[model samples]
Target chain A: MSVLLEARGVCRSFGGLDVTRDVNFKLVSGDRVALIGPNGAGKTTLVNLITGDIAPSRGQFWMGDDDITGLSIPERVRRGLVRTFQTTRLFANLTVADNVALAIMQRKRISRRIFSSATELPEVKAEWSEILAHLGLDHLAYRKVIELAYGQQRLIELAIGLALHPKVLLLDEPAAGVPHDEAPKILDAINRLPADIAVLMIEHDMDLVFKFARRVLVLAAGRLIFEGSPADVTADHEVRRAYLGSYADARHSA
Target chain B: MSDITMIHAPQKRVPFAQEAAGALTILALGAVGYFLYPDDLAFLTRLIGIAFLVLSLDLVTGYCGVATLGHAAQFGVGAYAAGIACIRGVTDPVALLGVGLVAGTIMGLISGALITRFRGLPQLVLSIAVGQLVAGLANKLSWLTGGSDGLSGIEPGKVFGVFGFDMYSRTGYLFSLAVLVITFVVLQRFVRSPFGLMCRGIKDDDLRAKMIGVSIYPRLVAMYGVAGAVAGIGGALTAISTGVVGLDSVSFERSAEVLVMLVLGGAGHLWGALAGTVIFMIFEHVVAAANPFHWMTMVGLLLILIVVFAPRGLIAPVMSLWTKMTRKGKAA
Candidate 1:
């Protein structure tokens, strides 16, 4: 598969401490990749570097063939490189639909229209409904995001990310704080995403990473230590020792 | 795919009916003021002009969530632009207003560039700093700006060369009211548009807004420019009608006072600005005259009362009450 998003020799450090160093990876089209590591393994930092939340210390990355090392976060998003927060950041005061509608509007480039009501636009309404329905959140579309459960908010975070029409989506722990029962909602939503877009998820739940990502990359001390299939990741002794800690499921899967 | 039917809420429709009614009320108030208290019309006109400043302040501070108190920088620039134009052989009201608009827009862009780059306390402090800087410059430029003594003798010609700017300020009041209404309507339209929605999103969460692909800085800059132009119109009106532009017009005190009005009215809702300014000004007018010595105390007490009773601003409680009443009417 051809690479859609590539991070080449990406490095980030603060106060002489490296958060990510010489981290290189490629997200090919339709790639379902898992980025897993122990605490402070720089998973989120890598995502931020790609999404332009923070500039890389010394490296260049690419969106397809276009070098986007200097683009702003919004500019990167406009170029189809999108990300979600670990804690699922959202416009808590806005309605679920407004949250989704805004991304769709930005994607459609109609967000700059100074006289057109986005909610009143039939196309916006339809797209909002469609995205909501995809996440099974159509019923709660009008409810303020703060009113929803944390799990549902995560789904909304995903919905907003999906609304960007991303060519590469870097999900930073999409199910981090969600309860076990509610976590399935997120998994269900993720499972339903169209496969044409590349999705790289950083998840602690090994089961979810295994279930969702066909390929897994394990990071340790800001380096890409292991990259293989989910089954291969579980069996890799270095990955288990450095990050996974214990994979009782590894044996069962094998 | 499961069937998903959207539930249309009562407030889903455009607020045309309500806005129209509000516009009518404003027109009615102006008409009544024109007839009933013709002598007091000048004061009212001045309040309406300041209301434009408050309204524009509401846009950047209220809607876009760019914390600013130096908005008077733009207002002062607008006033000086109009005053200077008038002094330099452009006594035409429309033309002077145009100069004010351009000046205000430029000031907004400049100040907005600096202000939008910072957040929280720094933003507020920068706003105050910028406002003070402009006031200082205006005071220093005595020859051009007519400093310390203030810009004077700014005489605007008759309305379309017909109704003269009389001693009673009847033309000024009507003209200010007309400008206020038109600008308010346009602002209403701007806030209701998709770009307006983007501003709201940016206001609620600019970080997430950026992640979702809204160009936060440029949009904010544009909003500031538009808002500055609106405020410029107000500043120009003050210059043209009052025939003076003073350093006091763009002082830190004016900026703080306008911020208070916006907060008093309800920041997010556009009409709340007008409501806050009108209420504040009316209370000031009536109480200051009646009490004279303790008027500041009275205004302070009013501010305290508003904070205690309506933390969201005076407009919020009234709006909620109105919605409750209408919902009850529907159920009944």
Candidate 2:
């Protein structure tokens, strides 16, 4: 698999304090990578840099051969680099199907068609309906997103990401607020994602991380400390000191 | 195929039904006005003209979530363009509207470029400034625009080379009513379009919209241009029907008043814009005539009540009622 996205020594700072320091990584197609870090490890900030939400003070990002450090958020998205929010960020007032349909229309570049209803467009309707149905969200298709439960809304977020047809999908804590029972559904949805897409998920749940990610990258105090298999992450001294403290120790004894 | 997608696709039906309902309401309203205010066709025509302005405002502030207080800038520019075109011998009504539409689009693009760069209160302030700036220029270019005295001496030819624009304003009223209905129908299609849905998405949350891979800035600027085009038509209609373009046409008060009307009727939905215009203008006319000295007080009271009760505007309650009734009927 070829590298689909690469971050080369990326750095960012707010005032005098560094938020992300010299972050570097490569995401190849079909890679399942999880980025784990403590509260201010700049995990989200790093994702922001990659997504062009904020400009990196140093280093560059590339999609294959194209340097994308200066591309706008939407430009990156159009190029198939897409992300989901840690907290669910959806078009709350619009219907679930419309929320997904908007992304599909954008991908198809027909969002500018002003003479026809978006939902009635055969191509757009087909895509959103298939996505919603695939995610088992067909029942919530016509309902306003706000009317759905929090866990359901997160699933909608995933449904939208899939609709964007992303080659590199960045999911920021897809299971953050989900109830325990509802989390497996999120994981199942994530697992069902197209096999060829590279997914970089930031999750605090180690159990989830082990199950979902084949490889994991750990961050501590704005610096990457480890990058390896899920089993290797627990035994890394630096990652253990920085994040997995008690859990790592328990696993070590076991 | 899931039975739900094939069998229960009310989403496909809602826009057409709502659009049909809106068109019929506009026609019914025009008929009522034609019979009840036959002598006041001029006033009715004026109301229809302002309806265009409110609808255009809805496209921007209501749909795009761009807070603008200077929409009159587009309206005024369109009016002046049509008026000047008429004076320069572009006497055809349709041609004059075309002139207004182009002029409004350009003005909308210019203002939208400046306004869409910011968000929240700053956007509102920028819109007001743009409105003031346009009004100020109109005031300064007295030689070209006729300044405070207003641009006059406009004489539009027959609408289609047959129907004369009569002194009683019969042709003008009918022409405006037809245009309003057509514009409403087109706008109904517009707001339900993917472009319209995208704008609604931006309004709800810009970041989410961006992450979806849709560039919203140009979309918003384009939307403003569309809004300007609509407002311009309204402005042109006013110039053609009234046979004049005044400083008030582009004034800050005109912008504020239309915003008030939009809020009163509702902002996001096209119907609210029309409803707001009809209710506010008629209410203003009746109250001002009844208690000219304290008419502002009564208008204020009505606005307060609407805000307290139907915060979404007067149309919200009616729409909910209609939807509820339809669902109940379906259940039955």
Candidate 3:
């Protein structure tokens, strides 16, 4: 599989402290990569850098060979590089369908239409309904997002990401605050995404990371400590010492 | 299967019915105003003009979530543009409105650019500054704008070159009402469109809207321009009806009053703006006439009651009631 996204020497600093120190990684098509890091490891900051939410103090991002270091957030999105928020940032007052429809409309370049009703647009309706259905969220389509349960709201965020037609999707802790029972639903939704897209998920729950990602990149103290398959991740010395000592030992004994 | 089909369900006819109802209400209002306040046509006409200004404010402050207190800048510019055009021999009423529309649009774009750059308190301050600056400029250019005394001698020709603006203010009132209705209809379509939905999204959360690949700054600027156009028409209506343009049109007080009217009626709802304008003006007229000394106290009480009882503005409760009644009817 070809690389869909690449981060070369990505570094960011808050004040004089380096948050992301010389981070490097590649997300190839069909890749399921989980970025595992302890709190304040600059995981979200790295996602922000890639998504153009915050500029990197130093480094470059490549989208399928095109250097997208200076592109605007919307420009990066247009090029099929998208990111979700750590905390679900949705149009809360709008309906679930509207939240999804806005993304689809932007993708279709029809968000600027003044004469046509958004809900009545045949193309937009078809795509949003299909997205919601794929994510098993059709029932919540007309309901305002503010009224939805937290788990369902997470699903809507995924639905929006799907609507953007991203080739490289950066999910910033997609299951952060979800109730235990509803987390599997989110995983199911993630599993159902198109096979051609590359997904980079930032998750703290090791079980979730192992279940969802084939490859794991461990970030510790602003540096990548380990990069390997889940099976090998637990075997790495630095990764164990830095992040997963007890969990890694427990997994090996089990 | 039943669930998926809902997406493909025939386009909801509810909004259309609602639109029809709103249009009829406006027409009915015009008729009632015409007959009930025959002598107060000039005042009624003035209310219609302010109605446009409030609606324009809603587009920016309500829909786009751009807090502005200087919308009167656009209105004043439009009024001055139309008044000056008329004085300079662009005697046609429609042509004068066109001039006002252009002037308002330009002002909207200018203000939108400056305001959209900041958020929260700074945005409000910037808006107030823009309004004050425009008002100051209008005052300073007394030679051109007629300054403190106001610009006079604006003689608007007949509507369609046949129906002259009568001394009894019959034609002026009718013309303003007709234009108001047309503007309302067009705006209804505008606010329901995809663009309008996007603006609503921006209002709800700009960062989410931006992350969804929407270039929010431009959308806001565009909305401001549209708001400007609406306010411009309102200003032009005032200029043509009253045959005078004053600094009060662009003053800080005018902007604050329009904002108050919007909050009173419901910001974000077009009909709310109209209702607010009508209710506030008429209430002011009657109360001030009855107790000119303590009229402010009554208006303050009314505002407090509305805020305490109907925080979403006067229109929201009525809307909910209508929805509840309609839903009950369908269930039965």
Q: Give the per-residue lDDT of model 3 (tens digit) for A1-254.
A: 79999999989999999989999999999999999877667787888888998998998999987999999998999999888887899988778988898899899998899977776688888988999998889988877788889889999889999999999998988998999998998899889889999999999888999899999999887888889999998888887787655456557888
Please provide, for model 1 over B135-252, each residue's C-alpha lDDT reduced to its tens digit, 9 standing for 90 to 100.
9999999999988999999888877788779778989999999888778777777886788878888888889998988778889899999999999999999999999999889999
Task: Report lDDT (CA) for all predictions.
Answer: 0.86, 0.90, 0.89
- Cα error, residue A67 of model 1, in Å, equals 2.2
Badly placed stretches (over 4 Å) of model 1 are A244-254, B1-19, B325-332
Q: In model 1, what are the clashing residue pairs, if there are any? A: none
RMSD value for candidate 2: 3.9
Q: DockQ score for model 2, please?
A: 0.58
Ranking by TM-score: 3, 2, 1
What's the TM-score of every candidate structure? 0.93, 0.95, 0.95
lDDT of 2: 0.90
Local accuracy of candidate 3 as per-residue lDDT tens digits, B174-293 = 999989988998898888788998998899988888788889899999999999999999999999999999999999989999898999998878878987998999999999999999
lDDT of 1 by residue, A1-254 (tens): 87889989999999899999899888999999999988778888888888888899998999877999998988888889889998877887667888898889889989999975566578988898999998889999877787788889999999998888888888888888889998888888888877889999999898899889988888888999999999898788898787544344344566
Task: Looking at model 3 chain A, report the run of 10 residues with the lowest lDDT sum.
Answer: A242-251
Model 3 chain B: which ten-residue window has the lowest total lDDT? B1-10
lDDT of 1 at A15: 85
For model 2, residues B185-254, the per-residue Cα lDDT tens digits are: 8898888889998999999899999999888789999999999999999999999999999999988889
